[model samples]
Target: MQQQTNYSNELSGKIALVTGGTKGAGKAIAERLKAAGATVVITARNKPDQADPDLYFVPADLSKRGAADSVAKATLERYGRLDILINNLGGSETPAGGFAALNDEHWESTISTNLLAPVRLDRAFLPQMLENGNGVIIHIASIQGRLPLYDATLPYAAAKAGLINYSKGLAKEVTSKGLRVLTVSPGWIKTENVKYFLERIARSSNSSIEEAQQSVIAALGGIPYGRPAEPEEVAELVGFLASPRAKYLSGSEFVIDGGTIPTI
Candidate 1:
């Protein structure tokens, strides 16, 4: 336990910001970074029902205009320095009937949330990081970015794909300046949103929850490891990437999909 505690404190003295950190993977990532001894700040549209005492919660819908600037201003006023930034805000609200079902608003929202929010946040906070001469920025993308699901998350996938490309290019531009940038692409994490989605599918089909989950998995090819990732699993990767352990790593996309992608 002592060794574990020491290991988790890897980010000591760092100030980190996690967007959409109210729940699900964002919450997990925030907690993980906090456990790693970073002063973690979380931003979402609303505060969580039960907030973590260790984290500073900032309320802002990052998809909206000027939200990124607002968060950066608040964070800078409070912490004075930003050592890490995690772009974990992303989702798809478009209905699952494929391209014809999607419209301009859906595409625009997805792109704004998944791609442009990070771009704006990076623009806002990166100056502080660059000034400090050290920092890490992680974009929590989706495996759908690479292996897209046309019927459901097409826009989300495309946005994430754009994010991945942008992250790589940004890393190339900034790594020489001592700021590290990377992307994490996770496949089907069993977050609260996914669980609720599975429940809804079960209710609609009059089937068991397990059946609904398996059906969704089958749609994504298959999880050779036989389960969706837990939020903490993804958080672990983010924590490492944010810490000095991964100091040598930058500009890469780490895919955590339980071997579901089926390619090198």
Candidate 2:
């Protein structure tokens, strides 16, 4: 008979914070860490649709000024320390068009959410992590950072590219101090928002959902795996990185895009 290993207590005494944890990938990560026995704290602008007593939720708009410090304060005050920080809050609301369509507000908002929010949160939490000589910081970026789609998500892609660069620099500075700073760049994730996007595309183009999905894949230069990743898949990667198993892993970017980006 084959033996199955139990990992329910891997992070038994750790404290973790996940931004944008109200839903989608963030939610999955929070749940994953919790399942690994971590005391998980989640933050977002709105309350979760369904609350789990096990997860601590903080309501805040990280894009706004002062929000990052506020969230860090709340988390530290409640838990005393954080062992894992997942900067997962990010999105793009710019309308479809080329570079000419984006305004300063669009650029600023995209940069603030995708890049600056994590920067601020990291600043707020680094002192304690450095003091303890250990912690993990994961920045959730996008494959668009490299494979940019100019007509739709130019600002978002630019911000994510900046985030990727920043993560690398941060890892270089902090890796010796025992804090692991890494970036996870995903291509197309089939989250609730993405599902809605596909529905909208299908409705607008008068095509089936599968056709809309194919159109998006074609627009992305094709996802070689033929499908977007599930939220749990990304969460699993995050869980492993936050665990002791990845102790030697640092200063790296893990791309979870199902081979979406063609270049090596």
Q: How high is each candidate's TM-score?
A: 0.94, 0.94
lDDT of 1 by residue, 1-264 (tens): 455435767888999999989988999999999998899999999898797889999999889889999999999999898999999999876666679978999999989999999999999998888988889999999999889988667999999999999999999999999999999999999877886777656765678999988878888899999988999999999998898989899999999999999888
Worst 10 residues of 2 by lDDT: 195-204
Residue lDDT tens for model 2, 64-104? 98999999999999999999999999988776657887899
Q: Considering every candidate listed, which one attains the maximal lDDT?
A: 2
**What is the number of backbone collisions in each predicted candidate, taken in the order shown?**
0, 0
List candidate 1 segments past 4 Å from native: 1-5, 199-211
Residue 91 in model 1: shift from native, Å?
Answer: 1.1
At residue 141, give the lDDT of candidate 1: 95
Error of 2 at 174 (Å): 0.8
